[model samples]
Target: MTPAPAGRDPDARASLPLLLDAVLGVGSEPELQATLQHIVDSATELCAARYGALGVVDPERVRLTGLYTAGMTEAERAALPELPDGRTGLPGALISDPRPLMPQDLSKDSRAAGLPPGHPLMRSYLGVPIRVHTEVFGHLHLAGKEGGGPFTDQDLALLRVLASQAGTAIGNARLYETARRRERWIEGAAAVTTTLLAGRPAADALMCVAERARLLADAAAGVVLQPTPEGGMEIVAASTHGDPGDLVGTTIAPGSAVLGQLLGGEPVFIEDSATDPRMTTPVRERFGPSMMLPLQSGGRLIGTLALPRPRGGRPYDAVDRLLASQFASQAALALVLADAQHDREQLAVYEDRDRIARDLHDLVVQRLFATEMMLESTKKRAAAAPAGDTVGEDTVGEDLARAVDELDSTIQEVRTAIFALQQPPSDAPTTFRGRVLRETGGAAVLLGFQPSVQFTGAVDTLLPEPVAGDLLAALRAALAAAHRRSEVTSIEVAVDATPARVRLTVTDDGRTTSGTRGTTRTWESAL
Candidate 1:
């Protein structure tokens, strides 16, 4: 070590290298939390103090929002009932003044707020405000000099320099974190858009958005709520750590204070959902800080995207609110585009189906009917021939008659295929004919061939919803029974509507216990 001149302080010279090392170490950490803790530890070591803490001030500077401590063992920390909020006593004074503080004997200092139970005793104290570009970031406090003496002017000076370096490090760390957070959100939004545009159902799209937002926001749960017919919002999709079944279907009634804001496409930020009077849902008690952002694009309000944390969780900052709101807007636009694409696809399918149906009715059915008529004519001619004119004239007439019947059945099958092609492909069938086809179509998967379906009278107009439902249930049961039977080759279903009643008849060609070739079941219901 170089010798100090007669008038210079040798202690300052001795601590110079340690101060430089502390400054280099603090700024090197990229993470904000790690940087803060490192600064506290370095400051405590440089000042030869027994305890040190760094309390970060909130944006408003009215209270301490975060605390990092060093020199406290895990057992010592666990023994304390709670950490201080730094809103009172010497810590508060430093935040307010933004100046260095040193007190000889904290027990005698009037500004001292006595420690909580199980806290270590302290006498000397030193505090300094860390500033970043003229704005106070936090305060660093050191207590109990190592040699049982009060903190000196040299220690205060050294602590102040270290605090200045910590400010710069904290700023760098915050910027890095903010940039990383933004990138994650952007990537998440892009992923959601890709999934939606790739063609997902409406329910699946909503759930995708919820899951992505929950992950990006680090929330305990994410949910999407849409307006119901009763002028309220209902949760249709939810993504959570646990089972989300209970959260789905939860509603915000029309008169809720928060409902108005959500419906109007306004964002609502709550510090604590459990205690907020505006939150009326029964599930609110499970969450703490919450953000309800309207998923809207252009002039249409789609729904609300809610991200909520569990109780006692960290509240969201300004950056979080901004990023999340932007994400919601993007997700809404994607949903609209996906819905439009789905409609276009459906229309295309309908056009193709109509063309095929037209071909069957115009060409295929016409040909089959013409063949049946020619066969009938031949059978008649065969019958009219003299008894000795041909070797097998009776056999010829019978063969011609059977050919005509087969042609007639072929024509009916073509017409049924045309009808099946004409119905909408994706939605649940509402009309009687459509529903019957749906039942028969489903059975085909298990039966290995489609059942022949025939409808007599205006079934759709005559049958009530109740009757139709019962008929569908009966048809399902018949199909199931047919599937269970051995040697089943075919199934025939018919629905007849009369002025006073409707009937469903299901017949299957399967060997019965008595070795019968067929079985028939009929269900009748009054109008």
Candidate 2:
């Protein structure tokens, strides 16, 4: 085999259509694995090679991390020897130099002396380094052009251009992976929020989050550790393919394993869980690698999320950690908000019950007092009447007695009204004024008169629980005060609410004459 002529124009348009179709055609698609396979196929066809592969470089291990091939049976491709590290073979050499390679004959070349044992079907080879900026990312290798012919200079130029485009595609794929991971995290977070708000138990909510985490991260298992009463940790939830009973309900002492780091409000990464010094039990051997992140809210450590990778899998990368941590934080916040909303609802119920109790007491007591007054007045008038004209006295006594009986019946009717008022509202009213009216109607019987009420300006559209309670209490007080005045004829109540403030006024046409009025007491004293 002879070296191809070197003076061919580097910018030749012969392979431009193929290059454009390969790079720009499927670059932004969501399916990353399929897109990568397309790149390998296009590279092989552009170079007219019988076999081709794109090998992803692993910096840490200094070897091929992943490999995709075209024009080979599955068994044949699987049997290919592994490419080693440190510039040993053609692929490694091209990667290290970050340039193109055009080897005419591999068997006759001294530089290819230590090729891996049992390497198959290679007499001529050509490759180009895929690069991002100045750093070499990987390499694209073509083995033996068709018809046993040497590769032309034009072939190397085309491969180089394709390699450049391939690098951009690889970068785009990585970015797409990141974005997809982020989208999954967001969906998981939303699910956690829904479960928590639906009033699922804390343990159940945590389990839901763990299950989603395992699926999103492609991990073997997931666990949630919550701080215990003894300043330790309790494994409240665990999601895994195997039996989770061993992990669930387990307790970890403070400063024990990765759970401790999480309890201390810091995230921990165990690239090799079996070898880490913190592993205190044989359980760590079950997983080869793992990542643990703290679930925190408002600077407080609420719990931890622990995820374990499958056996023979690489450790979690930066993107995985970022996504996991974000999900953990959202889960924590959801738990907190759910608890807070529940507490607020409970408090509102308590307040409403108390107001109902007070209103019933006021109405019942006032009616009973009026009944007692009517009975006493009748009794005194009957005793003082003369005994002459027995028939006339008897008629007078009968009339007085009938009036007392009627008053007693009215008092019983008022007691029934009070009983109805003692109960809370069954459903939420549509508007704030409607709620206010419902509340005021319950207390109206206590005032002994139907008070005229008017609403001016925009009444409150929706009253917050606190403001509603306050307004109900104030309205009752004002109505009671108006009823006590002898000159009071009509009463009017108004509520004016704006975005900035709420104001209420209660006015009555009532006066205290100099001689007929009793000594006055303040409204606060009555309350």
On lDDT, the leading prediction is 1
* lDDT per residue as tens, model 1, 1-527: 86668988888888999999998999999999999999999999999999999998876536778888889899999999977767778877887787899988899988887467898888999999999888888899998899899999999989989988898999999999999999999999999999999888899999999999999999999999999999999999999999999999999999999999999999999999999999999999999999999999888999999999999888898899999999999999999998888887788768757766776778667767777687777768777878797756766767667776666555545544444453455545569898898768866866789999999989999998988877876776677667657799999998888889998999999987688778899999999
lDDT of 2 by residue, 47-119 (tens): 7898888877766556665777888787775675654443576766765675677778888776566566655
Model 1: worst 10 consecutive residues (lDDT sum): 415-424
lDDT of model number 2: 0.71
- Model 2 off-target regions past 4 Å? 1-30, 58-64, 78-97, 101-121, 147-153, 241-243, 257-260, 280-283, 356-527
Best by TM-score: 1
